[model samples]
Target: MSDDAPVKADLDEIRGLLSVMPKADEAARDAARAREGQLTKPPGALGRLETLAEWVATWQGRTPPRIERPRVAVFAGNHGVAYKGVSAYPIAVTAQMVANFQAGGAAVNQLCAANDAELRVYEMALDHPTADFTDGPAMTEEECATAMAYGMMAVEEGIDILCLGEMGIGNSTSAAALAHALFGGKAQDWTGPGTGVTGSTMELKIQVVDEAVTRHLPEMTDSFDALRRLGGHELAAIAGAILAARVGRVPVILDGYACTAAASILYRADPHALDHCIVGHLSAEPSHRRLCEAIGKQPLLDFGMRLGEGSGAAVALGIVKSAVACHSGMATFAEAGVSDKD
Candidate 1:
């Protein structure tokens, strides 16, 4: 840091300055549940959606809430480890899908349009098909500074809710590597057969992550170091955006493996970060369920989804919206002239 600049030497101090009191909103939840029971339906008839709305009320700290214009930001970058054939798709697919997202040709695009959520796409610095798996998916310090500037700018653009997505091809390997680094486990514990890779290819994928970790373990003694060493450009930026959103008091939805890995990194940096996040779905990645469990989050859906365009998060928007609506809009039994079943 320069002499003229604010020193960022203490993460604890930064957290202390930004951390807000978390409201459990128990009253709001109880009221919503009571209203749900009186909704002209049997108890628990609405399944998880009813419970989901109650949680949304608690998250928003209101008897009735509103999540106006939720924003989905998809970060796109290429991983250097793709040359090892760990992924089923080519590195070009990163840029290709980034274009698709911008052009509204991807699944996330359709879901965002259907749900009427605002979407933003950022291209974190990705070079073409580099083989330096040891370096990582992100850029140098200068690049991170630049990305932070853009991320903070996005936070200023008025987002009530946030969700993260990734479009990198070999990022599953990077995601597994980040999970192992953040969670202290074997690569096999956090890796899965991503995007239809065969069993032999999966083995190779695990070996690559193990090698990347082994090569960098000696140099990394901290969470940020491990992230800077093993995390992708988009993943690192997503981590930054997550932290930024959390500090800014906006709830963030996490997509599948790669986006979840970014959340894991942020939580390692600051455990309080998890308090502001919601898990969008349980992915088809064999390791994803375990990863979500590690964070004590049960995803709202499980459609055998392996597609990571933030589709899961996009789909969850309705549940969140309905939850907000019920919390803010529904009348209590007394107000609506109905008797409580209980």
Candidate 2:
């Protein structure tokens, strides 16, 4: 091999990270539960809030889980398939939305501000969209691997939690295709009216998903192939970030249908792969509920959101912060001189 030969990225490296993925800290979870019992409240009255604290402790591997450095990453990419008239908006909207995000003019900006989380937008070669999978593989193995690598690098040291989101026009079609290929359902089951596609456009979206999966299914062989064959750069990046967050002991909140579809790839690779993450919300997209069931994670919110660029996850981060505040700040029964539950 020549020294100047292009260094190639391999999915095997991602699989290696998965094999070494860390599980939640059960000890931390137990400690959080013990503290929960000590809080001056009726047992189970706080409901999911109690479990929310425990979940944070479990995934962060620390008692009194902190949300001080929550982060939201929105990846934007163009898809070659956008040329197929699958979306109501033009492909140029992808880059334009990234600019709006950069200028703090998007919905995600306000949501992140409300949650006190840092918002970072990563553009995944907006000028170089993946090949349309209906025609061929959306990305070569190396291209997909590199995008995933870009996502992994989004995980910086000391982030308390990561919120995954995306911003590619027509990517709902990509998400549907990835889910259809990964989970073995009919194309219509995963396809939805993305970006307000209705009537004939919706039908075209489903056709695109079906044809893409049919063209690539024989060679897919595994979940990673499903991603590379049917996913966009931003989707591949989300998978990368999810894996990196697991390795770094950061809990994750995945946003909407597209983001969760990306994470589902890792879940298929290993059922335990998503142990450290949660779905941020129930998307208005029909397939999202089905996708969430397939991954065994319930949505944290049901605002009927479908905006995609991590907005839902960013909002859910506020809920996580609230859980941390109550868990860490509320006085215990002993401190408050209150009677314990009989």
Candidate 3:
């Protein structure tokens, strides 16, 4: 975007951009605050909704912020680690779900339709998954960079907000490994019953994450390095989409554990990297709560969701829409002929 032709990005370029990322527009944020005080509603009655309006304006760089064209981009991929039986579902389900998305049969599709947002599902080389990290890096620098670039392309022109989500067998395992490597924790602390695994399967998944992180810990020179070694194509794509959203002046809503973990790569690289993003909801996958706490982001909702596929983010878009409506559509105390607070 204005991120200087974001249609392309190599790993090194992404790393370079981290240091020069733009910040939310304080002028816009201040303007939103001023408008909130002038509204007829009592002070602080709207709670987080008031903050949400300001957040939208701050990131969108405008006082009268609106989300006329929100889009949900769901990236689907196959994880080679799934071959080791990490998730209860088979890897083939990833592609099948992508097709279901195209047919408007997935939960995300319905949520997008219900919320009046566009839905785009990207299949990130599902025919060729990355090599299992147990053996080596999940993707080479070039492959990972290409996936990022592909993700950047997902941000179509004129979208007001972008919601990020993912679908990939064993991706929760990858998300857990990413957390473990990036945040320094026991693999079990980050692991959960993704896709509803039980007992031995959960134990195996935790062991795999530990092994992957241990193998790559020394090689992880930076966040990008850890990402290339541990993140899947869909995960890399989510990171790219977030960077693109920030550069393009579009606020973002991240859905569930996998999407947030993917974004954590950028956050770890630069502390201010995710200034334009908000967590859509609290995921029930355990690490989701811990990871949100680690990043200091209070999710907008807590419906105990772990469905991924952009469902939660799409639902959260409704709240953002309401915030926009109330902030921009409501009359001021002066316009309403209401007495001002003493």
Candidate 4:
């Protein structure tokens, strides 16, 4: 049997899972909302926190949601496009940062430690960098499928909440290309100064994205095709992980631009894929705002974070925990002997 056969089968299985993925339980959401009204706080006083609690309940299919296990998975890959000078940092930074992640010295490590979340980093084949999409597809369809499957399997260990992150220099270029293809916009619109590229470097980055989009436009009709053409293994893995989390009915927290770009691919392929996702924060990257709007997710925090190591999501886990606490631990008006609105 050809190697492609197994890859196709795996991808088909993912499709089947997505098709059967359950929607958030509206009954549970309404129950949580009703309980919020009965909480000691005035109606709507808690603002988005109350809404977040209801969202958690709806996704968990319970009145009182619990976030017992939160996991953050960081997928690292090398992009051939980095050779085109899209990022100020060299591609070697991808591997070095992966080592830093494993060493528990990265910002994401510190944030995960502070939030009591487990961190898992997968270092994809950095030596075999993905093909530059400006010339051809970044990876074979089979390779993309395999990477995605790896991501899907990562969540099987069981998690109540999962956050997807990536570490690949010039990934923002790949992300911009994918976003441009999915959203039907000029490359400049989705392009941003990733890793602080500016002036000539930023202009070069935009040009590279435009060229890649033009080359891949013919095959951009399908979301997976666009992904394979313009996305790195890490991005593909993030999509797979998000899909898997949704299938398991575990809520996902999205980090920043690169992560959201991957989520956008899943969202475009299956709108239901994002049913269990909560945007962790708004990234400083300009395209991130548009990406969130495209996916219909309002970020939980807006701390101007643009780091791509799941730092935003790691920090936001505290907010998710708080939301769960309010939902499961807050005293109702009856218990508190507080008067409700007459």
Candidate 5:
């Protein structure tokens, strides 16, 4: 059998899995809300945290959600568009950052360590970047599907929460193209300074995005087509990971713009996919807020974070853990013998 056969099979399996993503358990959410009402705290005193607890419970299909064995998978790939000088950094930085991730020296490594989350980095051929989308499709459909299958395979047993991250120079350009295609927006609206490019470099990035979007817009019939035409391997893999986590009933924490762009593909593919996702933070990237709005996710943090590699998601894990702890450990009025409000 050809190697592509397995990948095609895997992609088929992913489609089946996406079709069956169970809705969040409204019963569990109701139970959590009831328990929160009964907690010793004043009604609505805990505010959004209370809602967060219930949200987690609903998605987890349980009353007291536990964020156990949190895992952050950072997918790294190279973009052919990087050769166009669309980004401040060179394409070589993609491989170098992947090495940094593996070496446990990157910011994500430190953040994952601090959050007690396991970090896995996938080097999806940064050495051989995808074809420049301005000229043609970024990858063959089979190759894109294979990359996504690799992402779906990242979800191991016992992982309760999955965080998505990406490392690809010029990925912002790819992401801009994706946003333009998916949202039917101007390229400038989705374009941003990735890694601190400004002035003429930023203009070049926008121009590149416009060129790619215009070239691919006619053929961008669906999310998969958009991905194949304009997405980095890392982005496609992240979409696969999101779909896998949803099917596995594992909640997902999304990172910044690039990561969200990947998740947006999954969201567009299956609206139910966002039912299992938590926006980790709002990125400083100008287009990130729009992506969050497009996905209907309010970020858990808003510290202007733009660093990828799941740094924001790793940081937000603390908030999730605290919310879970509150849900599980807080005493109810009956347990605490507290007087009920009149």
Candidate 6:
């Protein structure tokens, strides 16, 4: 293993913790399915809800898994590359959108509220409203450490599930840069227009990301170093938050491309991180699809929605909740007096 790989001691410790994950009760699931079949509805009529419930039960380690009022945590920051004119919207929009979330006026706020989920916004320190490509990424080691501390603390705030969202202008550029450095991909492969940038603007976006990835190549030894070089403050925080959620044994819903990029970082840091993640939806960004495919996960939605702030994840949570309900509330063949065809 490389120096960046987890020490055997820590690996053993994390493995022990993982071993404690509650085993899914096959008996309870059978009973639950029996109940669902007996419900005043046709078998499997509920579609994915039936599978979702069982998955939730397995995740919660309970027969009747209840989410207990989930919450959304949105992390916001500015990417140094937004100054490169890669995105149509100005970097200032990140902070502006943060305020929008706080005011409960943004798309995420509404969707979360409608889904009965509380929203918390974190404004990580970063160089805001970037002017051009001259400025590099603003994620210093100190900033990453602070973000790690804050994100870990945030996950401790009594949540059954945590959804991660990011609001950083030029964040897509940062995501591509991180993807290239961490995943060994060409910048153009991961680069995409963010917030409706035009064709020429996207070309500039890819170029800036390529430059960032090239500059950081030698130092990109591991996930932390890659994040330190190319990650936005929000991305770092989200990565730490995902780690904390896994440690705390709570499911984490990924919001969009930006947060998915952060999730990739967490997975690289600890492969087990994927065990706790519930990919929310396929983002509108083309790169997001590639990233999801690489991670071996599927999005719940393909609605062509690219608005960050965890709106996509928030909508996806409804299905997650429904899944939990079905798994715990359904009836089996015996209960319904139906013959088993399986």
Better of 2 and 4 by lDDT: 2
- Evaluate model 1: give its lDDT: 0.73
Candidate 5 or 6, higher lDDT? Answer: 5
**Candidate 6 off by > 4 Å:** 1-47, 126-137, 332-342
Q: Model 2, range 76-157, lDDT digits (tens) per residue?
A: 9889999999999999999899889999999999999888889999888887888988889998988889888888888999
Candidate 4 lDDT, 36-146, residue by residue in tens: 888888788878888888888888788888888889999998899999888988999988998899888999999988888999998777778899889899988778888
For model 6, how does the per-residue alpha-carbon lDDT over 1-342 read when each residue is reduced to its tens digit? 111322122212332433444434567566555556665456788887776665555455456768886989988777666666788988678778877887878998889878899898877654443223235435556555556556656686568888888888888888888777777778888987778877888788888888877777775666776776787667877877776776665778888888899888766765655766767888888889888887777887788888888999999998888777665555556666866655
In model 2, the Cα lDDT at residue 90 comes to: 99
Model 4 lowest lDDT segment of ten: 1-10
Taking all chains together, the TM-score of candidate 5 against the true structure is 0.95
Any idea what lDDT model 6 has? 0.72
Tens digit per residue, CA lDDT, model 5, 1-342: 122335543445566676787888889999998898898889889777888788788877888888879999998889998999888888888888887888889999998888889999988876678998888999987778888888888888789888889888989889888988898778899999989999999998989899888888887777888998999889989988888777777888999999999888877887767788889999999999998898799998999888888899999988888888888899998898988888
Q: For each of the candidates, give the backbone clash count.
A: 7, 0, 1, 0, 0, 14
TM-score of each: 0.84, 0.97, 0.97, 0.95, 0.95, 0.83
lDDT of 1 at 42: 62
State, as a TM-score between 0 and 1, how close model 2 is to the true structure: 0.97
Which scores greater on TM-score, model 3 or model 6?
3
Select the stronger candidate by lDDT from 2 and 6: 2
Provide the lDDT at 35 for model 3.
Answer: 98
> Please, what are the lDDT tens digits per residue for candidate 1 over residues 30-82?
87766676665567766777777776655555555568869988877777788
Model 4 quality (TM-score): 0.95
Please give the range of 10 consecutive residues that has the lowest summed lDDT in model 1.
Answer: 1-10
| Global CA lDDT computed for model 4 | 0.86
Give candidate 2 regions above 4 Å deviation.
1-8
